[model samples]
Target: MSNLNKLDFSALEVFGRNYLKWVQDVKLHLIVKNLHPAIEDKMDNLVGEAKKANAMIFIRRHIHDALQTEYLANEDPRALWVALVDRFDHQKDIFLLEARHDWQYLCFQDVKSVNEYNSKVC
Candidate 1:
């Protein structure tokens, strides 16, 4: 398996998006949803373990460290995935405030410098 990129806490949003794409690509997205039924009378425990292992392999050192002990103790991939999202998704509020601050400060100084002003806005 190719190495999945590490996610530093600050890059959670980007990481979450990329992680979803990666899980889907690997056909393991359903595992993160906590929905894995037994296959052909086989035990679901094996499938669950496989998914957990797959998730553990993708998690890098830093992000793994951010998890709570309870979450780390859980062998379920859905638990880990939910914990990560819950912890990091709170940053969206900070991002929104920053964007609003930037918008409030945005200005067009001079009509003569429209190109420069447009570049800054972009």
Candidate 2:
């Protein structure tokens, strides 16, 4: 895995574009690897920050072929907003619609494919 700072932004942009396509296509079990530790740490920080802001966080992990893998994937905006409105929803740290849009914007500026975006962001 390359250092997070060494990630290729151009590849990330392409990845984001393709990711949306994959989501629309409902391709499950997307595989992304070779992530920098720093990136993972940042994700942890982001989740903590969101929690502090009264947001819920949902972490999903996959264990297949004796391997454990994790990544931040798409979120349901409407559900997130409803949770926010309740102010008691447990799934608050997951990015809401607005946050997701912002993230997508940033990702689109960096990655080139869904796989590449997942790798760079993760």
Candidate 3:
């Protein structure tokens, strides 16, 4: 892990999913959640450590800038995660629109056979 380069999280599905799984594996997911005060007090140091680690993982300049202004300002890893989700969730919407357009523009001449075209259109 020490030899691994900084993570590139673009709020895209693959990157986001991998980053989340990494957080879970590192046992830092709790720092991002709303917990009781007693537990929160005990985990304060761990939370800071996780935040630092999370910051280091964001290699993108723009993302790091956002982290400085938004995530770090909030002093909570959860805020960063949520912000990334909110920003990237739009990518899913875009994909849906593109898929709809492709389906709407499907051409019979593009396919080799009627059966294939029928399956595609279906």
TM-score of each: 0.44, 0.19, 0.39
Please identify which of the two predictions, 1 or 2, would achieve the higher TM-score against the true structure: 1
Best by lDDT: 1
Name the lDDT value of residue 92 in candidate 1: 66
For candidate 1, write residues 1-122 as lDDT tens digits: 34445342322233454443333432343344344332113444555566556555444233424343445686655565556656555656776798888875555534347787778768
User: Over the stretch 1-122, how does candidate 2's per-residue lDDT look in tens digits?
Assistant: 55633412222122233333223222122213211121222434333333322211211121111111212222432233232234423223443666888987987778777888788778
**Local distance difference test, each candidate:** 0.48, 0.32, 0.46
Backbone clashes in model 3: 0
- Superposed model 2: Cα runs more than 4 Å off: 1-96
Rank list by lDDT? 1, 3, 2
Global lDDT for candidate 1? Answer: 0.48
Better of 1 and 3 by TM-score: 1
Output the number of the TM-score-best candidate: 1
Residues 3-120 of candidate 3 have per-residue lDDT tens digits of 3644332332333434443434323423333221212324354544554444434422224353455455544444544555565546566667988888756775589888998898
Return the lDDT, model 1, position 100: 85
**Residue 25 miss distance in model 3 (angstroms):** 16
In model 1, pairs of residues that clash are none
Q: Is candidate 1 or candidate 2 better by lDDT?
A: 1
